[model samples]
Target: MGKFDDLPETRRRGLERMEQVYGFDMTDGTGDFFRYTADHLFADIWERPGLSDRDRRLLLIGLLSGSGGADVLGIQVPAALAAGELDAEELREIVIFLSHYAGWPNGARINSIVENAVAQASRPPK
Candidate 1:
């Protein structure tokens, strides 16, 4: 059997959910942090039924902006676009809307991240 064959059901579910959310395979990671991320964060939290992925993404964007989590946003912004959870226009609008609450600097940072992700998405495969 391959490495994942022995994984607990939650870990397996989490890895699948991670791929669905991020538009990429996430099975290569190791260690307890990776395990907890996949098992708890993705499986238990993200898989909850009350909110759609887009809704979660929007909430996460606000939290990230408020906390100055630009690096995580760098990953999430692009993944969110790739997953078709948010379009470029909506992302730009988020920048404007969030600017008022998240502060100008955080909004500017988010704007740059969103613009870059949008630009990257528009590029032809090389």
Candidate 2:
């Protein structure tokens, strides 16, 4: 059996949800940080009601932009696109809109990441 085969229901649900959100398998992650991420962050926080996944994605994009979370955005942008949570046009517009508030440098970085993600998505898999 795999390492997480006997995980509790919450952790199991979190791992499932993580794959749904990120568009990739999450079971390969290990250690305490990954444990808490699946157990709490994904299970409790992301599963909370009142906000759709798309809503959360948009909110997270803004927060990431403001905080200069380019690295995280590198992950999030592609996931958002793959999940159909945000399209390239909407993403480009977000960068334009956020440029005024999040600062030009940060916005520019996000714009580049968004474009790259879009480009990568359009390419046929090797």
Candidate 3:
């Protein structure tokens, strides 16, 4: 079996989850990035036996905060809320908790970014 066919169910669920979380579209003929993301990152890594989606979200939040990934956070933060992986309060707590480990500046910056995203997600479309 091929890589995708190796775990068909896992691949399918991973693809669906990936789309739900990141709006990842492979249809535009983008490049290897999307293909790899779908086939590997989501299909393989995300389908691993352990670590719930919520766990992944929290990790991504911290990782992104330290790595200067505001653009990615714009997608992840709101999706976490919408998917019930996290609520606004939990995200706020994460920022506060991460502040010590990730340092004051980075945590504060992430807090601001996440808060704005939460607000936007809560607002009705204009």
RMSD of 1: 1.8
Model 1: number of backbone collisions: 0
* Model 1: CA > 4 A from native: 1-3
- lDDT value for model 2: 0.91
Best TM-score among the predictions, by candidate number: 2
* lDDT on C-alpha atoms for all candidate structures: 0.90, 0.91, 0.76
lDDT of 3 by residue, 69-104 (tens): 877877888778878788889889988998888888
lDDT of 3 at 52: 88
lDDT at residue 1 of model 3 (Cα atoms): 48
Give the per-residue lDDT of model 2 (tens digit) for 1-126.
Answer: 654568888888788888888888777467999888998999899999999999999999999999999998998999999999999999999999999999999999999999999999999999
> What CA root-mean-square deviation does each model show from the true structure?
1.8, 2.0, 4.7
- Please rank every candidate by lDDT, starting with the best: 2, 1, 3
Model 2 stretches astray by more than 4 angstroms: 1-5, 28-30
Error of 3 at 22 (Å): 2.4
